[model samples]
Target chain A: MAVQVTQAGADTKTGVSGWSLSIAPRRGALSVVEVIVLAACIAAALTMTNRHGVDIMIRTFLWAGLALAWNIAGGYVGLISFGHAAFFGIGAYTSTILLLSYGISPGIGLFGGALLAAAAGALLTVVCARLRGPFFILSTLAAGEVTRIAALNWRSLTGGAEGLEIPAISSATDMVFATQWPYVGLVLSYMLLVFALSVWIERSRYGYYLFATRDNEDGASAIGINPGVMRVSAMALSAALTAIGGTLFVQYFLYLDPTHIISPDISFEFALICAIGGLGTASGPVFGALIIVPASELLRGWLSQSASGLYLVLYGLVVILVILYFPSGISGAIARGWAALTKKKTS
Target chain B: MGGADKKEDQLMLWVEGVSRQFNALWAVRDVSFSIEAGEIVGIIGPNGAGKSTLFNLIAAAIRPTSGDIRFLDHTITRAKPYQVSRLGLARTFQIPKPFRQLSVRENVMLSALRRHRTPHRANRLAGETMEFVGIDHLADTSVASLTVGLLKKLEVARALATEPSLLLLDEVMAGLTPPEVREMMAAIAALPSRGVTVLWVEHVMMAIMNVAQRLLVLHRGQLITQGKPAEVSKDPAVIAAYLGEKYAARS
Candidate 1:
């Protein structure tokens, strides 16, 4: 009789609200342990690079930096922006233009480019912060397209679609080293900056507010946080960090193409990196890049060398699977598994 | 019961001729009431009598169409809800809205952090609030896992985390059992001892009678009576509003 009544209640509309109220335990220990694991992984990455060839090491570090920068706003703040490539392009172009055209050192151009990206990001956020969900995403994508078009048209500054070539700097202060050592140092420094900023944000009160805002904006506002300001600040910080990554990319490659820098593929990769690792977790992006970059390179090596689009298709499939089954990504899944293990052990 | 001394000295929140119009109709029209400090004032009326609407005006969740609200000697008619909270005011929703993804401790910690800038101090305050609300046992529990009664307690805990001098509780005792109601009343009654003021709205007349120092009866957005609990309970208007015209006519 009780089971029948329960079944009837489940079928009825009256129990809809009650059914929706189903609660789940939050992931807590995962955040702390992930950070420690990420730190170890970073050390391992640095060491492995010294042992292996420098090209692989430098590329890995660059991707790590990019992932970390993208995750600051997308993962932590829950503003899944697909226009981070605009900031990347801005930084690359700014540095490349300063170096190739005005004879400014790449070192000074790095800071200059970052500042420009930060300013642009802040302005974009202010205009688009009122838009929620997909609207915000679309607006940012549009902004990135505008930037890409500007870069393509601005012939004198950006060298039109032919791209800018950064000459080799004879001086050490110019930041163009003759060997892979300089690239390693540059990538490691930016990665450290990203790590420090992510740590600071995770520990800060603003970080708490950002999470709260992402989860529920009304609740955050009720608790005295202005969600707009928090989101904008997060985006600006994200842009600055991403710009630094762009600077490092230019310095390492010694070349910049507008299409390559401002490509939608790059933005998609950033989102994919965060999603594959864990969206909201601090170390998720690093984990994501670690897995994806290598897997991608390996796929390229094994399959046709020209199968670049296959990586994206694979990413899209993973994203779908993650959304449907895991919803928390690989890091989140691992955390859940660990929790279950611990619970089983305790029991 | 609306005496000179009570009117002159005890008025902490003054709502003068406030009205909230929606298109052609007034949801709350020309409602005026003043609540004194350290008093648990209960506002009771039928559904859509604008009880919640009036509370929203006082909490600055919505601005009054035309009126002034002076809270703690400051005009807060146009102040935002957070601004009101910062000025020693806090409120709970009809349905408890706990930060579902956060732990019980983190939910209270968010409120404490809003009121206190530093994390260490906020955590301390959160601990004290959880203890006070008798939910310290469930401190580490996820808010999603809490029962309705526990969620209500968590709501109160979060409100108290703001260190509010004035608390606006909306139907906090609505769904509780009699014993739970008594327990909640005792907890609310003890709030004044900590220098916190309460303005509660409850459908449960017994809980209101038990906890409220004074009562203000509202019928269709207008104050019908204001007096001591005993006096107001016996008033013809109050009796009529609650028990219907037949009882009032017979009495």
Candidate 2:
């Protein structure tokens, strides 16, 4: 009925409430293994960029960032939006359009694009405030499709269905880079910025509010949580972050099109990545993006010659297994295993 | 009982001609009453008599079709539930709506957080409230796994943590055993001492009779009569509509 009805990210070591706060040892948002994983992510970003292929590493970081953004609404607030690509497209289009046509730098365009996407997100959620479950999902789908159509038809501004290209000028100020390493650096910073934001949210009072609002709306309201207001704010924040990801995407690719950027498939990818990693938990999205992005990319590389769509079919099978058996995503399963192992050691 | 303590009678709530209609039928029709500060009022009625609906109207979960409700000086007839709650009015559900994923303490912290900005203060407030309701032992337990008695206690604890001047509880004693009911009754009886006025709706007659200073009886969406519980219990209309002939004959 709700997103992540199973474990999700709710096994949160961020259990800062209860008797744990007073007597028990404080567990930071990330655990030991999680810390190692995060460190590895940084280590991989710095050294393995040249060795393990820059394309794969960068995509991992970017997808992880996008997944975390999606999890804020879909996992934490129980707003399963299949319309994130709209924000992504808005971000991509806004910056690319401004930089290419108006002689404006991409940095200023970045904030402008994010703000516009945030407003669109808040508007979409506020309009569909009364909807829940599949109805809300369907409304988001409709919203995404409408945006895609508008982007496709708005030729004079968007460069139409043909798409727009960024200047290949290699300048530090332009945000364009000659080597793949800077793009990797740019993507890593974006991912870390998003991860830090997620951790801050998980530890802050606002994090508790989002969890309460998502877990039980009426119960949250009884304590003075305005569900409508909270949902709208969350939608805006989530969309703004996702839009930043979109900007990163355009900067890296130097190209933008309605088909690739604004497609509903992109939106689904963001949500699916979160779900498969662990809904509602901080580490779940990172874990999901880390595993799925490379796995699918590798699978596609190997399977394309033998059979078309086989990799995706296999990917679909993996998601179904996780949703059915794991339910809490890969992070949850790992947390549970870690718990059991610790319990045995102590006993 | 009109034999109330009678000292802290500062009109906490005023409901004037309140009526809530679902389409044509009035779920609560022309119900009017006033509760004094620090007084515990019990509202009782048979099935479909609008007891829960009255609580809903008072809590601003649903707006009344007509009339006004005032909490102290605030006109709350059309206020949103959160706004009403923020104005020192808090409510508990007939069926407890616990945050299932949250630990019991976290559930209470959700309410306490409104009163205390810092999580530490909220945590402390939640602990104190849980202590009041005698559920301190279940602090770290997940809400989804709580038993019925503990769930009811958690429900009361959550509302109490909000630190409301006025509390509305709906059927908190239902499904509880004799010992659980006694424990709950004792907890509610302690509300007044904390400067909390209460409006409780319950089918569990014995529990309310022990806690309320006065009683209001509803029949068919209208207030049949209201007075001291001792007096209202003996009224002919209340006896016939609710307590019935068997109890009437014995009394």
Candidate 3:
């Protein structure tokens, strides 16, 4: 027999009174705004003729991709790593070495770089599985420093403090191009690939696991979701993606060194871009890169002759003020505003 | 009483000589008990009586200083919380531990993922569980906006979504209104018919007495007595240790 039981909150069926709880509305795959943004980015990359402008766009797209990669670990899994530059350096070195020594195309070598970086990421996660919060963050920072030092000292393959410069050979197969247009397309493709992946991941069941683990470890574990496994997998995936971004950076610049590629500033740049845009949402990093990269580059270009390093101070102030005033970042503010607008229009 | 003679598989849970020590204090000490399938056992003790510690030990959230816990003949003394949870044992936190970033439906869906591998099926299961617990209306609402009673109900709904054979409930009725308590009791009392054996640690006397088939009175990390609710309620030792003479006389 079915036992008929009355609900305790039958009167609350109308819903909780007077509390607008939607801070950030959940976004599905390829929202209208996202599509518009993607179209705009593609148009700008394709139509822009000025070499300087194209350079900025390429950097913008690359940073956007890198920030999205960091969000997998830092935003989704709450693994705020300050050592992603290590993975970036590894990827740049891997592809460059393979190309310089064995005559392998960077097209194939990028995958090899991604694989090695993923292995390193998995190892770091396992080793620091027991740590949390600041300890975990510090461990990543130290790991980045250690990788940088190792690269700096081991001058044999990495070319020491100088750097490895990819030869200027305009070959499509080798991923080296004479004109900036090809690179504009190449980097834009990379950005779109990461964007598509982020959209897929944000909608999948695995995304739910990542969200749960981030919010509460004990609660997630109670439901049979292993936090350790989730963290490791997320770190590995994030690292592999970051490494791919690094390889693209090397190809674009055609040069890399331990000091520049594995610098803490590079790691912080990826994280800060995510922070400025929004951390977890797929579109946050894109917005962040669009807003930050152009502003920084334009400020430096316009103000460099007049004021030496005023751009750095101004850039620092903007980042600080954004973080202080809008803790959820720009993407979160937009989401909340949109939610409020829709609700007002309906009600 | 004769649970020891029964086959290990017949028992839903067997806790043997379990003890947990933190510094100088023994939170739980050498406690042994067995609950047969389809049993509803309530563990009652005063504050700091090691009830939660015992629950934690059984669930493998914390390791026992010494002892063994078995779920249907499988040793889970050293198992991780997720491993124990995967073995058909689900538990609730003493305090509601909802995933704050997720909606109410998503919180339940996380546990539903244990039985249903896909998020779509898990979402359906979550909806059913929510309806059963009377929180279907709050499906898309943020967990931060929920009342204490609603949060507790969400916890139960999440645990139930896992389709466990054994369920551990820790202080689920602590802050509920009288009517809310009655509703929760009715829901819990119906679990046996669904093949779930409940090990509940509760402080609410009147509610537990009416619902539990058996009661285990604990005092300062030791099992003072275990018997039918009526017999255990009347035990003088239990009256002195936990219930006090005033409540005992009234009962």
Task: Name the top DockQ candidate.
Answer: 2
Docking class of 3: acceptable
Give chain B TM-scores in order. 0.92, 0.93, 0.93
Sorted on TM-score, best first, the list reads: 2, 3, 1
- Candidate 1 segments whose C-alpha is farther than 4 A from its true place: A1-53, A169-171, A305-312, B1-11, B239-247
Ranked by lDDT from best down, the candidates are: 3, 2, 1
Clashing pairs in 1: none
Q: Against the unseen true structure, what C-alpha lDDT does each candidate score?
A: 0.76, 0.84, 0.86
| Model number with the top TM-score | 2
What lDDT tens digits, residue by residue, belong to model 2 across residues B29-68? 9999999898999999888999989999999999999999
| Candidate 1: tens digits of C-alpha lDDT, residues B1-251 | 23446455566688899999878878888888887788788888767778898888888889999988988757899988778877888888777776655667877888888757755568789889899888888876666666777878888888888888889998988777777778788889999889888888888888888788888788877788888888987888877887898887788
lDDT tens digits by residue: candidate 2, A37-151: 7889888877773544679888899989998998888977889999999999999899888888886778888898899999999999989989999999999999999999999
What does candidate 1's lDDT look like per residue over A38-127, in tens digits? Answer: 566557655665433456666766777788888878877778888999999988888778877777887889889889998999999899
RMSD of 2: 3.9
Model 3 residue B67 lDDT score? 87
Could you report the DockQ of all the candidates, in the order they appear? 0.23, 0.50, 0.42
Q: Worst lDDT window (10 residues) for model 2 chain A?
A: A19-28
What ranges in model 3 sit over 4 Å off? Answer: A1-25, B1-7, B243-251
